[model samples]
Target: MSGIMKISDKEFYSLRSLILEHFGINIQEQKRTLLVVRLQKLLQAQGFKTFREYYNYLIRDSSPDRLHELIDSISTNFSFFFREHKHFDYLSKTVLPLLVERQKKRNSKNIRIWSAGCSTGEEPYTIVMLMLEFFGIEYAMWNAGVLATDISTRALKKAMKGIYSQDKIRHVPAGLNKKFFNKADEGKLVINETIRNNVTFRRLNLMKPTFPFKKKFHIIFCRNVMIYFNQQTRNDLIRKFHNVSKPGSFLFIGHSETLDTSRNLYKYVMPATYMRI
Candidate 1:
């Protein structure tokens, strides 16, 4: 505790306001100490002596890189392959099958899925694997892939590497693991090119006023990403998602999250699952 730097209340509020305005993350008052602790090393590395100085530097920096770094420091990036199993079951049992049938009727082979806030690539990769398994030999006939976006460039870099420790992939279903991953040195599993190539990872901030996607998505997985936001931010983001989703498209959120269906953009399908109406 002797070497620890404390953030003044005013400094904490200033930093909190900036983060809320730019990233839509509402840091609670209780997290003031946590914020100081998390940012202490960053400040030392940047040679800043006080939180006020760091705040000034953050505002003066023109490039988004600093902001990104701040986000990387503050945001939690906890994820693994198939962290929640029920959603995957729903995806396999209901969503993909319906989409496939709909597309077939239209004589179209294109399938679009968006994995919003896909940290370190687990969720999106799992989706691609499921699609491949669902279509089997016919997968090659369809223009199907997943667009995985997250705010952390660091996470995206790790996702692009396509390597995971055995522990990280421990919950991956059997047989599929053998088919999609190869054993590397030091007990690591490297994702095969087939699954890795089908999932594209990009850095995107969900707080942005506009999403720059040209095509509407049939399925959007934004699980566990909105827990950091306030209710207003979450509602605004859900509206944006509804606008960009095809009618009747599936939206999968974390099991702990609930939507205010009164907005009428989406109708409840099940816990944490909604269909764009």
Candidate 2:
């Protein structure tokens, strides 16, 4: 009898607030109806006929999965292979060349990169392929690994599998397809385990005070993840990303985002992209 649930205004407001606190994402008033639609099934699953009960259950249940579910629902996951080609182009044409020179000066060949909110696996996979091309597989002996994280366990699982539908391969380069991807039994493109193992997937909530990584990175791709947060939260997260990077490291954001007002020690390289000090 309690299988049906409807979210009212009060419950919707409270849900929005908790989501922002837990995920650092700000939901606008226009999204109220959308929230109701998404949570309808979730409330039903919890055997609640109202959002009030579901919200209370969420607060009381301190299990990590509950929090993870809340985050997964609110987070945006739109990404594709070779997304925003300009950034990758920039990485190849300018950034990699510059970094090569910088590495020579530093007398070190270590390279570390992070793809924050790497939905599934597209963005980070694109990165490794480009890295292999830039350094040349034969000469690319430097220690390199991508640390990818997302709040969604479901997405992370798929990312770990490194399998994608044939439709998803269009944005990826042809050469990469020939070199790294294979046609699986399902007739879909499956990334070899070698590349998948090279990436370490972890569950990370960006809203936390500190990211648990010890080593600072040279480049971080946090693209499209900030659009969900409010200005203040966005500013805070950007500062956090900046603090975690070494001087001259790069942060790539959504194509439509900018840090003009939240500006700190980052110099603009292009729209929605900057280099940290």
lDDT of 1 by residue, 147-193 (tens): 99999888999999888998788888899999999988888999999
Candidate 1 stretches greater than 4 Å from native: 1-3
TM-score of 2: 0.93
In candidate 2 the C-alpha lDDT for residue 224 amounts to 87
Among residues 3 or more apart in sequence or in different chains, the pairs in candidate 2 whose N, CA or C atoms overlap within 3 Å are: none
Give candidate 1's error at residue 122 in angstroms.
0.6
Candidate 2 stretches with Cα past 4 Å from truth are 1-5
lDDT tens digits, residues 1-277, model 2? 4333466778888888888888877888897767766667666666777778888988897788887877666566777888899999998888878877888799978778899999898888888888778777643477777899988887888888888887777877777887879888778888877677678888888888888878898999998888888888887888889778989998899888878534567888888779997
For model 2, what is the C-alpha lDDT against the true structure? 0.81
Which candidate wins on lDDT? 1
